[model samples]
Target: MEKKHMLQIEGLTKAYGNKIVLDNLNLTVEQGDIYGFLGPNGSGKTTTIRAVLGLVNYQKGNVILNGFDIKKDFKKSIQKVGAVVETPRFFENYSGYWNLKVMADFYDHVPRKRIDEVLEIVGMEKRAKEKVKTYSLGMKQRLGIARALIHSPELVILDEPTNGLDPQGMKEVREMIIQLSIEQNITFFVSTHLLSEVEVLCNKVCILKRGQKIEEGVVKKLLNKDYEVLDIYTPSVKKAMDCLIRDNRVISINPFSEGFKIEVQQGYADKIVKILVEDNVPVRYVIPRNQSLEDYFIEQTKGGEHIA
Candidate 1:
């Protein structure tokens, strides 16, 4: 039997001053799944989060959490959700443990050990006693996560979780989020503009353009192996591309720092080499180009008509 869904949004619509931010949006996130939501600026990523969390009232559709309607019982609908929409507000002078304790007290019946467990889950148990002022930005972000998890929420929503971190900090948070999904069976729904971050962390994603979903699917299939990039560099770009300029298979050869960038038809490496050698153009290197989530994201959002 399939597990019960953690979140369900059907035909969700929200507008601001006659500006339609979300139009008949629909989505579902199951437990143990990390859904990456990507879109450009002003694409309603924040609006979607607000609607799901009940911070903003909407005119149409339903936002349900574990079958409980958000409109009818706000308490029940939010019980399983823990989200960090922006930077978490915390008392700077207090230690991490103290801050968590203060928040946990608001929700009666929270266990004593829950605070420590959440700190440990985010790898902050050792530093829990340290003053919040001394914590790094990454540490603060993790604390926000710990605070979110203090209630044992089934779904954790993070927006730009790694916004200003250095490389190591980004990796730290990324690994922690992934570990949570694997070890504790936590479900993550993250909204981010960083393509590589989403690609590395999320298994599925829903892309929005001007508040409308343009593509949604498993990351692996959405990127389709068939779209892999092929990088062809030649020492003599002008000479090498002379034979294939007018050919139907070759798109365009661009001059680059190392050599010339040759965009060829998909899976046409064999033909590219054969033509190059036949025309006496010295082929220096041919390798698969590493593509980030940004490439696919740009292709999906701005590749065609803009929808508002």
Candidate 2:
């Protein structure tokens, strides 16, 4: 069954004076999807996010939250969405519970029980009474996520959610996101420059470059479409290299400390091995290289300067 879209962005365009930020961008977030909105420093990711939340006015486009049009029903549409952009801010002197209490007061129908529930969901229940000023950066981030959920929003949008955390903090936040998505069935649209985080946490991703979407799809499917990098170890390096070099599927080959790192088209590993064996080349081992999200991102955004 086709999952219903929780958020839809169509023909979205935003311009700043003479410069264009988002150029006719289109994206979608389906129900229960942990969608990753990815781009380089100045690929219009933040601008696109702001436009969706109605934080900035765009020259053209429509943002639909569920079935409510953001333009026509701003309050109703926005109420269903929760966002923590850049950083989550709170009164330093106030306790975590108090900070969430204050936020809950702003929205009608938000029960006190809901605040406790969200706090527990983010695993901040123990420190709920502690002052925000005394909390670590990771704790504060978890509280920020709790605040975003206080109103029971159907869709959560986060920008750089783990920007400054240490390794442990990043892991906690990542696990929390997965847990919330599973337990609460909430849809997430997160924008971040951390490719590793996106690779681990997101099932779907949209890559934007120079204010335009260059690629968008499932992470596994996208990575599987390309060749599987392999490190071929053989005593007969010269003979194996010469035999495989003639194949049209071999993309590139480079000498490694152990052997040669070869990039070959998918499904050509067996054929390459067979050729080496047929030529009486002594093959030691073949190690498949896993492609990282960073490698893919760098390849896609080549020649583009990093922008703020």
Candidate 3:
């Protein structure tokens, strides 16, 4: 069976006056994908989201949602989409059930039973009648998700869904997202600054930097690409460094407090060990450094913090 594309952005470019915010960015989300949209501040993550939702104007490219062109068919394109770009607003004094009831009023197809169904899906059924003010931040977040899902949207866009959450709260939201993706077959387009969350939750990721996509791939494959980083501990740090520096396979080496961090082409760790040992250098231990999503992000962004 041919896979269906839930969302597609081709050559998407956005600008504020003369400054470019999104530069020829392209991305695609397939059905049932938990796709991570990641970037430092001002990398155009928000801009791209806004463009897709038609909240902002883009200078170039096109956004297609569920085979409908957003620009040419705004209403139909957005019908299958729901989003919580930031904190969701609600009538603080109103019960959760009432809040969703009010929201369901905006659409003719959403039924009263749908509200109860969504509440159960988000694990908020027990507290569905409680006032919004009494809900914890996590509970409120779950409510926001329930609201987003009330229409049974095929794709949901969430920006920092777990922001400001405690560890338990974050875990709850994370597990909820995973469960929804598995059980409902809904596609998720999530933007988050939390690299650890993306590492565990997203099946694929797209990294943006300065309005450009610098990296995009499956999470595991990207992290396991053909590069080996090793932390070598030895008394003769200087000798080991010199020996490895001479090898053409070694990419770069930096000294740490106890040892040196070395980067080399994959499958060359054994060669590095053999070279150091043959040079009469004291061999303590060579530990394989696990490359993390954060490490990869830092490398691509060049240690740049949120820009603007």
Candidate 4:
């Protein structure tokens, strides 16, 4: 059997005034996939989402939702898609259940029990009757998710879903997204600057910068650094670098105060230690810097930063 995409963008481009926001960007989210759009703040992550949501006018590109072109079947394409970009607004005075009911009213087939089911799905069953004003930030986020799911859409898009969340709140939301993807088999298009979160939740991710896509690949594949980083504090930085650079396995050496960094197999610490000891170079400490998704992102897209 062949897999199909839930959303597909080809040669998508966008700009604001003289500055480009999304330049020839192409992406796809397969059915039942948890795809992540990741980059720094100014890397056009939000812009791409807006373009995909049809919230912005793109100068050129084609977006296909299932088999329907987003431009041709604009309303029909979005009928099955639900999105929450940035902070989701709600009726402050309305209870959580009431808010969901309001969104549910937009579609007729969704039953009242469906609202209850979604509330439970987001782990807000106990807080269903509570006013939105009384809800915490995490609860509000969960409510936003519940509202999106209220209509029982097949594709869900969320932008910075964990912003302003405490550690526990972030963890909870991450777990919820993962659970929904695995248990409910939902197709999720997630846009986030949180690389660690993307690393944890997304199977595929794209890195954007200055409106241009710099890299796109599977999360693990993009992050599978061929060489690990080894930092060693020694008495002579230059000498350490010179000796380490002789090895064919070493990629590059970055000099640091009182030490240097070697990009090589971290397990070969014994080889380095032995060399230094044999050469009578005092080795203060040898450490391996555990690379995370953020580390890989920074390494891949070296110049981008949080612009927004």
lDDT of 1 at 229: 46
lDDT of 4 by residue, 1-308 (tens): 76788998899988788887788998878887889888777778787778788888899999888668888888888888888878888899989999999889988698999999999988999999989999988889999999988888888999899988998888998888888888878899988887778888899987787777778888888777666887899878877777778888677788887798878765665687788788778889999877777777667677437622
TM-score-based ranking: 4, 2, 3, 1
Candidate 2 lDDT over residue span 1-308, tens digit each? 99988889998989999899999899889999999998878888888888888899998989999878899999988887888877788999999999999989989999999988999888999999999999988888888999889998889999889978988888988888898899889999999877888899999999988789888888877776567688999877777788888789999888866679888998887787788888998889988878876767777777435422
Q: What is the C-alpha RMSD of each candidate to the true structure, in Å?
A: 3.7, 2.8, 2.7, 2.4
Candidate 4 residue 137 Cα shift, in angstroms, is 2.4
lDDT of predicted model 1: 0.82
Model 3 scores a TM of 0.88
Please provide TM-scores, in order, for all candidate models, with all chains considered together.
0.84, 0.88, 0.88, 0.90
Worst 10 residues of 3 by lDDT: 299-308
Please give the lDDT score for candidate 4. Answer: 0.84
Candidate 4 accuracy as TM-score: 0.90
Query: Candidate 3: which stretches are off by over 4 Å?
Result: 242-252, 264-285, 304-308
Better of 3 and 4 by lDDT: 3
Lowest lDDT block of 10, candidate 2: 299-308
Candidate 2 has an lDDT of 0.87
